[model samples]
Every structure is written in C-alpha cells, then in structure tokens.
Target: MERIAVSALRKTFTLKPGQTVTVDGVTSDRIAVLDGVDLTIDSGEFITVVGPSGSGKSVLLDVIAGLTEATSGVARIDGIEVSKPQTRTAYVFQQYALFPWRTALQNVEYALEVRGVATAERRDKARHFLHLFGLKGFEDRFPSQLSGGMQQRVAIARALSTDPQVLLMDEPFAALDAQTRDILQSELLRIWEQIKTTVVFVTHSIDEAIYLADRVVVMTARPASIKEIVAIDLPRPRDLDIRNSAAFNAYRGRVWESLRDEVGKAQRDWALASSYAN
Candidate 1:
C-alpha cells in the first residue's frame, strides 16, 4: 500500500523556441496545461482520471510518476515529494514501449535487470507475472509476433515485475479493439486485486472510469484542474455483467453529467482556435 497526494499541482508548457511574450517586461513563451489540481489517493486504491483529450490527463499522470516537473505545487508518493523518477513507481503507456528485440519474458525481465536483481530470480519473477497476466505459453514471443493486447499485457507484466508500490497507467488499452479493451479491463481489475498496488489510471471512457475505479477524478478543459471527484460504492470482484446493471448506468450517468460541460467547452475552444487559424 502507498499513499499519493497531489497538492495545488500546476504545469505549463513552452510552445516553441524563442517564442516570447512580454508581461511587464517579462518575456515568456508558455501556456498552462494543468492548473491547481488537489487530490489525495489512499493506499491500494484503484483510481481513474477522466477528461477531454489534451486536457492534461496524461501530463497529470507524468507529474505524479515523477517523470515531469510541476510548474507549481507538489506531488507526493507516500509523503515523499516526487522531484524525479523513483524506483517505487512504474508507468505503463498506451504505446506499449517494449524492446522489439526482446521476447516477452526478456522484456519483463529487463525491469528487474535494471534494478540489479539476479538473473535467476528476475526470470522467475518475470515468468510469474507473465503467467499471472495469462501469457504463459507466449513467453518467447516478440512484440511483433504478439497482438496489441498481448504486447500491452507484456508491458504491464514488465511494470509489475518490479513490484513498485504505485502503478501509473496512461490509457494503456486505448489502442485495442472494443472486445480487447473489455477483456483487458477485466484482466486489469484481477491483477489489481491480487497485487493490491496503488494505481492511477487515466482514461477517456466514462464507463471505463466508473467500472475500474474506486473513485473517478474528472478534470476540466485545459488548462485542466479537478472539476469533481466521484466515489464508486460498488462491491468488489465485479464482473462485466455489471455493466448492464442499473447501478452501473447510474454511475456512468453521474460521471457524464459532471464531464459533459467540460468536454463541450474543450470542443468549443478547439473550434474557436481553429477558426482563428483559418
């Protein structure tokens, strides 16, 4: 179990090289992406974040992962400020960044290798994770030889093999088909139950958020900030059959109600900007 606290988190991005603006003789070429996010996640919680595309959901995850510096405020993991990438955290991205040359087993073993785990122990750990993720027979398969879902599973196994206290996932199933996405979502929950590791997952689907999370964090349009936090009161060991339940639809509706205006605003903003450009 690991605790996470993001206090007044802010992030701004510089658009271009030497593109400066003057404000009281201060020149800058920056725009705010995330703004003043404040949230706390308890240990072993399954949390999902939802927002419009480009609303800084991924940026927020990166900040918490210690891969990106905040422009203001703080992100802490277990009370320690995240200033840089730490061994206590692992990230799984949508792209499934696996080593093309390495087999699934080898790729999972790589994380342990970097942590200085001995070859035998790491191999055993990697095999266990691969088996847990239901990739038992495909251990030697390369990334190209496996399906997109399998590759992402390997990526997840790689992350979990390190036994990190916190796992940060940025839409890891976004690339898969509808069926694959549904299956992976179930697999993820199963793994979460077994591992009991704190997880911060970002997704665009309202149903997915409500289904997978104990609490869903909804962000406003960019410059993003926490617009609302919705707690899921559903029971554990949930199955896909619950998606058709009235309670499930109610959760989905609640999240959508909170997110509708923000998503519309984001769309309008993009349209306005495009109109200006054209």
Candidate 2:
C-alpha cells in the first residue's frame, strides 16, 4: 500500500522584493526529499533524505506534513490528498520544541491531552512511551534539566504518543554531539523496528541516512528535485560496525557524488540571497 503519494510538487516563497521558488518544477516532492523527486513510499517504509543545506529537503518534508503548502502539486496520505495537517502524520523537529513548563511526562502527554484522551488513559499511554524511550526515570524532569539527546528522545516519544501512521522527522539528531547522536539513532531504530510506522527522515549526514533508511533519496540544489534513490540493501538493526563496511562507504560516496554539483549551487544561491538582502 502506498503510504505517501506526491506528484509534481512545486513550492515558491514570496519575499519582500521577489519570489523564491524553493521547489520548482519538481514532480513528486513527497518521495522523501529526492532530486527530480518522483517516488512513492510504501507503507511501513523507512526512508531517509540526504542533501546539502538549502536543497529543499525540509521543504519537501513540510509539504508531506502539510506544514507548508506546495505551489503546485499533490501530496496524499493513504490515497487522500493532503491539503492541510492530518492527524495521521506526526513531525519530530530538530529543536525538541517541548513546552518548557511541562515535565517530560506531561510533555509527552500533551498531544494526547489535546486529542481529549481521558486523563488516566493519556497518562498511562504517555508513561508507556516514555519508558519505551528510556525516559522512565526522567519523567519528572523538565526540558531544562535534560540533556540535548534526552530532550529529543522525549520529542520522539511525544510524537509517537499520538500513534501517527506516518512519522516525519526533520534532522532530529543534528543538534546532539557524536556520541549522543549515535545512541539516539540506535534507540530510534529500535523504536521504529517495534512500531512499524512509515518514516520519512531528513538529514544532511550520509552516515545517518545510510544507517537508518531502507532507501536514501538524494536531492539537488534549489528548486530541488530527486537525483537518486539509493537503496541501502543493508540489513536491518544496523550497527555502528556497518559504517566501516565497504557497502557503507560505497553508498556514502554515491550520495556525495550525486549531490556534489547541487551543493555548490545551493551555496551560491545562499550567497546570492544574502547579497540581495543586503
């Protein structure tokens, strides 16, 4: 079954002086952020998007999440066109975006609370996910008290607490240090393995994309489109040792080569944008 269907998505942002089409003339921006991106994601698929900064990777994800509108295109979840945010999708952002006043458990329960889950049931479900994320003891801790990775874990648990059919993550691991990022990545994989949610993940790190995705969708620069959908062909429950394997390097090299020109173009575009702003 198709979990996400995107066709001919083009998005433009109107600036004060001009319009910047972040995604232009692209068909299928919904296939997990690829260049020339016409792709379909099957239900329960774990797909990662790897591109240089400003390659419209996040824009693609936002379109799928319905956070941003596509200027011209179609994004559907479960065969229904998504014109706005749907309850079936949940997004975990890089910044952990938790309520500062809420404790970890309370934060996790926030979504359920909003959905009007009964107090007892919501607390129970929230506690379960918190425990699932290894956040059992930290339930009482505020975001200020937790480390960066822990906060992200809480964010993930919170997103999952809503029982979303599809998970959209925008570089959730980027803010953490190397060791913490590795640990959370491993933990996230474990959670995904158990949950079987269709995941569309965005990241700039080749290693992370290679490690986590069944397929890596590499994208081009501005007005970005899918360049290639590199199947990892690597076995699941991926371990750090895989990063050293020849297969890992092979995939990483392919992504870099595919994105080489796009990276340059994106950098130049940024410089141009800065110049225009000034």
Candidate 3:
C-alpha cells in the first residue's frame, strides 16, 4: 500500500521586492527548490534522500510533512492532499528541538499531551519509549543535562511516542559526533524494525543514507528533482560492520556515482553565485 505520494511537485520561493539570488550567473527573484518531483512510498518502508548542499532535500521533506506548501503540485498522504500537517505524521528535525525546561520524559510526553492523551497514560507511554531508547535512568534529566546523543534519543522518542504512521526526519543525527551518529543509526534501525513506521529520512552523508534506507532517493542540485532511486538489497538486522562489506561498498559506490555530478554542479553554481555577490 502506498502511504505517501508526490506528483508533479514543485516548490518555489519568491523573494520579496529587491531581493534576488544568482544561480549559474543568472539573477532571479524566485527560486525553485523542488521541480516536478514524483515519488511513491510504500507503507512501512524506509526511504532515505541524499543530495548536494542546497539541493532542497530538506525542502522535499518539509513538503511531505506539510510544513511547507508546494508551488505547483500535490503531495498526498493516504490519498488525501497534504496541505497541512497530518495527525498521523510526525517530524524530527536536525536540531534536537527539545524544550529546555522539560525533562527527557516530559519532552517525550509533550507529543501525547498535545493530542490529549491522559496524563497517567502519556507518562507511561513516554517512559516506555525512553526505556526503549536506552534513556531510562536519564528520564528526569533535562535536555541541558543530557549528552548530545541522549538529547537526540529523546527527540526520536518524542516523535515515535505518537505511533505515527509516517515519520519524517530531516538529518536528525547530523549534529552529533560520528561515533554517536553511528550508534544512533543502529539503534534507529533496531527500533524501526519493531515498530515498522513509514520513514522518509534526509541526510547528506551517503553512507548514512544507504545504511538506513530500503531505497535511496538521490536528487539533482538546485531546482531538485529525482536523479535516481536506488533500491538497497542488503539483508536486514544490519550491523555497523556491514559498512566494510563489499556489498555495502558497492551500494555506496552506486549512490555516489549517481550523486557525484550533482555535487560538482551545485558547488560550481555556489561559486558563481558567490562571485556575483562580491
């Protein structure tokens, strides 16, 4: 079953008067981030998106999350148009975004609270997820007291507390140290296997993209569109050591090969735009 569908999706940002940007030596008052993107995501499938900097990968996620609107197309969840955030969808952003005053348990409970879950039930649910994320002892620790990795765990726990059918994560681990990132990656896969929510995760790291995806969606540079959708053939219960396996490297190489040109083009465009700004 298709849980999310995007068709002819184009997101444009029109600058206010006197504002402009240079792209490939051309100046424009409007920027097209997503251009005619078409995709179908199956229920409970994990999809990872990768692209060059400024390729609108995050924008695509925002559109699907209904945090942003498309300029000329449609994004749908369960065949219903996505014009606003859906109750069945949850988003985890790159930033931990945990309320500073809230304890880890409180942060996780916030989602359920918003939905009006009874206090006793929400508390139990939050504790369960916190334990699942290995934050049992730290449940009362405020975001200020937790380590970066632990903070992120709370963020992920909060997103999942709602039992959302679709989870949209935009580089949720990007800010962590590499070792922490790797740990969280494995932890995420472990939890995901048990819950099986449909996921759309955006990442700049090719390795992370491949490690977490059922399919990797590579987007072109600015004015982004699908470059290729590469299916991951690796077996499940994947360990971090799989990163060294020849099969894993083969998948990485394929994704990089498709993405290399786009990376170069995005860089060149950035250079050109920078020169124009000078």
Candidate 4:
C-alpha cells in the first residue's frame, strides 16, 4: 500500500568556503534541512505536511518530486528511487507558474503535449478538466486576464489533466485571500473525491491542513524529521461546514500543541541570525 517511501533521508547544503550562518549564536558552515527523515505514503492518499517556516517541509516535497537530491538516503515511488522528474508525479508550486502566453486551455494541454498525447485528444482532455475546475467558459482567457484564484484553478486543472498518480503541492494557496482559499479547498476535495489521486500538499496553515489532509505529517525544526502523523477519522466528501465542528477544533488543538515549540524555535533562530547579521 505504500506508494511513496522515504528512508533515513538527509540533505545538507554546504556553503562556500567563506559563507557562514549563525543559528542560536553558533556559526555553521553547513545547513542541514532534512536529517534522518523517514516516511511512507500510500497510493490515493491525501497527505498534508505542516511545520514552522524553514522546517524543510518544502524540501521534503522537493526531494520526493526529484527536484532536489538527498545528501543521503532515498525517496521512492512505487519502489523506484526518485532521481529526476517522473511522469507519475506532477507538482504545483506556490506561484501559478502558468505560461502567460498560453490560454487556460493551452496551459492544460501543454502537459499532455509534453507526454505525447495527440492534439485533438489533449485539447478535449484539457477542456474537460478546465470545466471540472469551474473554468469552462474562461478557457480562452490568458493567465493575465484571470483573477489570482482563477489562475490557480487553471494551474490545478492543468496538473490534474495529466492524470498523474502523485500530485505534489507546495503552499499552493498561501497567497490567496481566505474566501478564495476556502473556495479552492472545497473544489479540490470535490476533484480528489472523483479521481482519488495521491496528493502530498505542503502548507503552514493548520486549518487548511486539517481540512484537506486525511493525515497530517508534522515535522521538526531545521534538519527536519517527522514529529507526528495524525490521522483524521472525519467522514469524507467534506466541506467548509466541518471547520466549526468540535472534532475539527480538537484536531486543530492537537496539531497546534505539537507545532508550537517548533515555531518558537524557528522564531528564536531567526532572531539570533538577525542579531548576528547586524
């Protein structure tokens, strides 16, 4: 059942000879963002990761996506080690990353085109996903012509159009207003329910993590490792209404408890580094 596996993962970024960073008043020549991290994700699972800023949540996603290689250990999908971008995975970054020149439909079709899907079929597939994401009538619009939320929706549609077995998202809604984020969250759940694709989403919002994740992966401070894996037993096909429920609050409380110390440490480290910089 494990579709993704990461074992004893360690990544160290060695600075140039003269480069140094001070953390907690200690100067360091190397930065360890992920150290001894081990995790397993099942197929068709929706997993969300939450940690303080700079806790390497994004790095973990990058490693799995094969955008960054580990200094040690390995990450694998379906038992194959991840070394480079693979067809089975699609990544949606914080930025829309849509080609400004490409219309919504064209943007969606681009992935299919790269995979060698024929013109007519890719167009049909792109149109269908855009429609499903509530951008049916706006497929002709360019990314510049659309609202921030609309552009992100197009990005999501494009990612899904490829029918990837694994979807990796890095704070995909971090820049959006609350109302837009709420809308997209529900829409994403709708799409996920229909298609049941495996998703690994990284976010800092506890509320968003609880709402979207079937299980939440909490990571430690820099040199990240799994701190906790909390499972949500809530019924599926969820909506925003669940946000107000006692069970929801309970989950939020639990996750926050695990996260508070990490956040404090990160803030302290930042303050220390700032003082050193000054």
Candidate with the greatest TM-score versus the true structure:
3
Ranking of predictions according to lDDT: 3, 4, 1, 2
Instruction: Flag regions of model 4 displaced more than 4 Å.
Output: 23-26
Which regions in candidate 3 have their CA more than 4 angstroms from the true location? Answer: 23-26
lDDT tens digits, residues 33-101, model 4? 998999899999999999999989888989999999999999999999999999989999889899999
Candidate 3 RMSD to the real structure: 1.1
Cα-based lDDT for every prediction: 0.92, 0.86, 0.94, 0.93
Worst 10 residues of 1 by lDDT: 18-27
- TM-scores of the models, in the given order? 0.95, 0.91, 0.97, 0.97
Q: Comparing candidate 1 with candidate 4, which one achieves the higher TM-score?
A: 4
lDDT of 3 by residue, 1-278 (tens): 99999999998999999999876578899988999999999999999999999999888988988889899889999999999988899999898899999999999999999999999999999999999999979988999999899999999999999999999999999999999999999999999999999999999999999999999999999899999999999999899999999999999999999999999999998887788778
What candidate 2 gets wrong by more than 4 Å, as runs, is 17-37, 275-278
lDDT for model 4, on a 0 to 1 scale? 0.93
Clash numbers, per candidate: 0, 9, 0, 0
lDDT of 2 by residue, 1-278 (tens): 88898888777655544433333454332323333356699999999998779778888888899888777778889999888888889999999999999999999999999889999999999999999988879999999999999999999999999989999999999999999999998998988998899999999888899899998998877667888899889988888889999989998898888878888888887786688667
Candidate 1: Cα lDDT at 204: 90
Task: Give candidate 2's root-mean-square deviation (CA, Å).
Answer: 4.3
